[model samples]
Target: MKVTEAAAQLGVSPRRVRALIADGRIRAHRVGVGWEIDGLAPSKERRALSVRSWLMLGRAVRSRALVGLSGHDRMRTAERIRRLRESDRPSRLLADWRPADAPAELYLDSLTARADRADDDYIRAALQRGPEYLRSRFDLAEVVASERAIRGESREELAERASVSARLVKNIESSQPLTSPGEVRRVLRALDIEPTALPDMVLS
Candidate 1:
């Protein structure tokens, strides 16, 4: 189908359709003065073109937020308003622009997690821990505490990453006592510490 026809059938603008084609997300080829798209392809082609404008608006918002351009960056935040006039989406997001402008660092951290297809808490925690935060200790529990301290991450956050209770993390860090094999593995894995390198036993 022609780009314009595909855009119309998908209930979006030709501009968005062209953008998708350019990004190689949509299967298409340019010929002569126009482009052709395989609207019926099974490559998620017909999955859902529903988010065209919404994604446009979202990209705009994220771009503006990245540039620290609060309430500005109309293409990302405002241009679509004229097309979809008086919609609640823009109004709602606009209301909380301040928070989105600065955006918590965890938000992007979570995004990186999602990008890696990492669904487990331990993996998320490890990514958040980062390589620079790795510790140099050989003791089991002390290594755990050192790992957490090096990252400057709270017990609560580490607990979430390990998918364990915060109380358990605290106890491990404080008492330095031995626990079940599984619990030790979970905590160490969350901290990105090699389980075999530091067993549950105390190191001399």
Candidate 2:
């Protein structure tokens, strides 16, 4: 497909497609004199939205407070919008983006309970505790917080990297009695950090 056609099919603009091609998000091939799409679309069917973008769109779609978006269409919409030029896209949707106010303990507790109830050994043990599962179970708050302290990554950076906020990070960090386990894993995963490097923390 021509860049223009590809853009239309993706519900984005020609320039947006071109930029994505340049960024290597959407693969393209050189034809006679123009670029042609190399595949049906990018390898990933849908791009995850930044937490900020999600909040903005949620605001426009309704009134009063709302929780996070669920399911696939939201994923597709986020992918389409992310590839578009920011200025050329729709009006700014989010007010001032922050993380959802879900209590970190609640999700972590649920995950722990499930792990305890499961009878399997390795799978149950890994489920009982692992970086990916912990992140999902805890709504990714702890990971966000540690990044803030270590790297000073903003809400925007965290959103881009893992789709959450500084407030969520701070909350998780301050979640007294310290539900630090989940975040410990989250921080390592988010920052591409290796566990062996943290001998002090690990030994302690």
Candidate 3:
């Protein structure tokens, strides 16, 4: 099938199909000026890639290499590693991967638990002040705090990176309303976190 036909079948744009081919997420061969894809082969290849991506993600997380990476870069690295793992025939398994494959959920849960612990600690501290001291608008506070902690960044260090004042970073983590919303966006960017990932209150 042609690129357009494959794109239609995959429910992705033609450009995305070309990118997948380039990334080895989809298998295709050049036929003169165009590419030829076997029917349903793309789907099978994508499924294989997904599994490989998860395996690579697990390895990266274990190594702590995923800590400071932007979400986009982390996934991209996983995909790249998957391709290398597939191509390298010297060893079937990458170093640190157990002799037996473990469920992807284990790694996912470990990462989630680490972040959750940070968020929970922040929330508990807030609750100690008073139930009424907590503001719904500051819901993003936990998110920022958790992500920053996961990245091993101090408030002062994050403020310096974001080009904001350390006091402002402290206030944001404390769930206080900021006089300048732009500072919040800056902090999020400094953490390599997308603002859209948080609650809508962040934007407001």
Top of the candidates by lDDT: 3
What would the per-residue lDDT of candidate 3 be over residues 86-138, giving only the tens digit for each residue?
22220112221222244546754454344334343332222121111113436
lDDT of 1 by residue, 28-137 (tens): 87788788786634424223223343343344323321122223342333434222222212222222222223334444334333434523343223223232322222
lDDT of 3: 0.54
Cα-based TM-score, every candidate: 0.30, 0.28, 0.34
Q: After superposition, how far is residue 28 of candidate 3 from its true place, in Å?
A: 46
For residue 192, model 3's alpha carbon misses the true position, in angstroms, by 1.5
Ranking by TM-score: 3, 1, 2
Clash count, one per candidate? 1, 2, 0
| Residue pairs whose backbone atoms clash in candidate 2 | 56-93, 56-94
lDDT of 2 at 111: 34
Superpose all Cα atoms of candidate 1 onto the true structure and report the RMSD in Å to 1 decimal: 17.3
**Maximum-TM-score candidate:** 3
Global CA lDDT computed for model 1: 0.49
